[model samples]
Structure formats: C-alpha cells, structure tokens
Target: MAKTVIVYFSGYGHTRRIAELAAQAAAADLVEISAEGEVSEAGWSQLDAAQAIIFGTPTYMASPPWQFKKFADATSKKWFTRAWQDKVFGGFTNSASLNGDKQVTLISLQTLASQHGGIWVSLGLAPANTKAATRADVNNLGGSVGALVQSPADASSDEIPPGDLETVKLYAARVADVAKRLHG
Candidate 1:
C-alpha cells in the first residue's frame, strides 16, 4: 500500500482534532506545522517520502492561516525538484461560520497541490442538504472540492459537527485508496 501523510496547522485545536481523525481513519502519518509556521525536518522528510499528502487547516478570513501559507511557500524546494510529482493530494478546511467562504481555502489548497504536480482528490460524497438533514449526516456542508467542517464560534474543538468528522475520515480513506491504486 502507498504511504499517506497528513500535514496540518491548527490554530485553536479544532483543525488538529480533524487531522487526528483523518490520520487514524487512513492509517496515515500526522505532521503538525507549529504556530510559528515551521515544520520539523523529520516532518518534511515524511512528506517527501509519502505517496499521498493531505493538508488540513482552519479557514481564516476566507483563506488558510499564514502558517499554512508559510509551509506552502517552504515547499518551493520540493516543487522545483519535482519531488512531489504525481503524488496524490487532498485537503480539508474548518471555520466558525456555516458559510465561511471555505471554498476559497479549498481552492488555495488545490492550487498548491497542482503547483506541486500532485493529483487532487475531491470529497466524493453527496451533500446531505435535504430538509431533514442535521449535523449527524455526512456531507452536511455540501462540499465537493474537499472536506468542509464548521465549528460554532463558542464551541470547543470537540464540538465540531459529527458529520464533518465523519466526512474527514471518509475523505482520508478515499485519498489513501487512490494513492494505493496509483502508486502501489
């Protein structure tokens, strides 16, 4: 099977929880980008070795946090060397509002993967936007480009909607499956 790795930046632990769930579901390695926008050398090595890479981050002001941007910038070396060429990639984003312009964040992540010559994975789940759908239903947010999670502003990290958590697990599994098929 192809190895998968999740590299994420969590501002207030919410995104961290999602990354943990994703890593567990996909049996992937977890690498956290520090608050200072730095990833350890080991983390970079893991990314370089993985057949699949997933990015998780909180949507800040309709985009990823500056720390994620920093990490993306630092990957320029990998980009120039074609180290990540043909790798499978996926991403997820979280925010406080139900419609927090999360698509912008997803696009940014997709663009990053494209720039790295990676194959991007979509959420691949149908939205549960019907009248009776609730937080417990998968794809409650109707996201397609990537997983989208919404946590209320006042809620703790654990308070992220169950549907979103499930979405992350499913998406991670999908990315892993694709990587295994393509790279193994």
Candidate 2:
C-alpha cells in the first residue's frame, strides 16, 4: 500500500470531520496544520515520505483559510528542492453556502501542488444531477476537481450532513487506489 498523508486546518470543525473520514477511508496519516500556521519537523518528514498528500481546508472568502495558505507558503523549501515532485496530490473543501465559491479553495490547493511539481489527482465521480438527487446524494455538488461540500452556517461540527462525508471518503479512496497503483 502506498503511504498517504492528509494535512488539514479546520477553522470551525466541519472540515476536520471531513479530513478524519478521508484519512479513515484512505488509511492515511493525519497531520493537523495548526491555526498558528506551524507544523513540526515530523510532519514534514511524513509528507516527504508519503506517496500521496491530500489537503483539506475550509472555504473562507472563496479561498483556503489563512493558516492553510501559511502552510503552503511554508513549503517553499520543499518546492525549491522538488522534494514532492511526482507525488500524488488531492484536496477537499467545505463552506456554509451551497455555492460558497469552494472551487477557489480547491484550485488553490492544486496550484500549491503544482508548485511542488506534484501530480494533482481529481475526484473522478460524475455529478449527481438527476431530478431525484437528494441532499444526501454523492457528488451532488458537481465537484470534479475535488470534494466540495456545503454545511449550514449554523450547524455544528457534529451536524455535518452525511452525504458530504460519503463523498469525501469515496474521493479519498480513489486517491489511495491511484497512489497504490502508481507507487505500491
């Protein structure tokens, strides 16, 4: 099996739940990007050793949280060394509004991966766009670039809808499968 690492910074907690489910599904190590915008040397070691790295962050102002950006900025050393080149990369994001510009966050992650010369892995599932598509349906958000989810503004971390998590698990599985095939 390919070694996988999930690095995430959850502002409220909804994003943390998604990251946890993704880590569980992928059988990957979970590294929390601190709100203080710092990661231990061990965290960098895990990222360097992993075959896959998945990013998770909340969508704030149509982009990733500031801490996540700080985390990305901190990777300049690895980027300069091309240490993560060719590693499989994937990402996920969540927001309060149904159309809360989550795509911007996903794109930011992809761009960061690109800077590291990593291969970006996308969510391969088709959009569940049928008339019967429910809020609990998989890929209902029509996110192809990455996992995108909507949580109610007032909902707590425990109140995250199941459908969003199901999609996150499935997407992480896809990334793990591809990494296994490529690096196992």
Candidate 3:
C-alpha cells in the first residue's frame, strides 16, 4: 500500500476535525503535533515509510501555529538525509476569518516542502467563486496551495461548513491518488 501520514497541530479542534476527515478519506494514519513536542518513535518511522505527507494547521496571525513550526524545524535531520525528497507533500489549513490570509500559510508550507525536495500538491478542486456556488459546493476553487477551510469564529466543530469538508476530502483523495501512481 502507498502509505500516507497526516501531521497537524490544531488549536481549537477545527483544524483537527478537518485533518481527521482528510485522513479518513485517504485511509492514512494521523499524527498530532503537540506543543509538548511529543511524537512517538513509531510515528516517526511511519512518516519515514510513507509515500505522502499531509500537513494541517490552523492559521495563526496569518501564518501557521508556532507548534507546527517547531515540528517543521525538527525535520532538519530528515531533510539533510533527503528522506522526504520526491515524496508527495500536501497541506491544509482552517481559519476563523473568511479570508484569513490562508495563502500565506500555504506559501510557508510549500517553501518548507521545497527545502526537503518534496513534490507539493495543490487542492485540485476549482474555486467556489461563481454565483452558482453555495454552501453545498464541492470544489474549493481558487484556494491556496492545498485545502482551505473557512470556519466562522463562533461555529462549533459539528457546525463546520460542508463545502470545506468536501474540499478536504477531494484534496486528500488527490494526494492519495498521486502517491499511489508515483510510488506504485
């Protein structure tokens, strides 16, 4: 099987929900990046074995959370070894504001993946910019480098927008498909 891992840091559970959905869709294992910096040895092994790595983070001040940055920094050893070179790399993010500078977050992620010599994947779905677009829209067109989920500040986990969830599922499937094709 083409192994895939979803590594993410969620602050308020919104991004966590999206990450879970992506993992489920891709049939991939999940790894939560915590502020305590606790990552299982087995998880690191799994990451090394995986064909694809998906990153999810909540937009903090128009960028990724510091915890996620810490985790990324810790990957330098892997980078030096070219461990992730040519692997499929995808990213997703959730933000409170509708236009919470999500592109900035994706740009940061893409830059990091580039440093590792990884292949970055975009959200593949089309933008939800047309007048026909509704809450039930499927693709999240014109989004950032990867999946982009917009949740209202007051919305609860159960209240996540369906459009965003659909976009994430589609993005995950695309990543899995790409990994399968490239690694098979």
Q: Say which candidate scores most in TM-score.
A: 1
RMSD of each: 0.5, 0.8, 1.3
lDDT of model 2 at position 142: 92
Q: For residues 1-184, write the lDDT of model 2, one tens digit per residue.
A: 8999999998888888899999999999999999897888999999999999999999999998789989999999998889999999999999999879999889989999988888889999988899999878889899999999888989998877777889999999988888999998
Per TM-score, what order, best first? 1, 2, 3
Worst-scoring 10-residue span by lDDT in model 2: 157-166
lDDT of 1: 0.97
Per lDDT, the best of the predicted structures is 1
Q: What is the per-residue lDDT of model 3 for residues 29-98, given as tens digits with 9 covering 90 to 100?
A: 9998876655678778888999999989999899998889988998998999999999999999889887
Local error of candidate 2 at residue 97 (angstroms): 0.7
The local lDDT score (0 to 100) that residue 108 gets in candidate 1 is: 98
- Pairwise TM-score winner, candidates 1 and 3: 1
lDDT of 2 at 50: 96
Question: Worst lDDT window (10 residues) for model 1?
Answer: 151-160
What TM-score goes with each of the models? 0.99, 0.98, 0.95
Q: Which runs of model 3 end up more than 4 angstroms from their true locations?
A: none
lDDT of each: 0.97, 0.91, 0.87
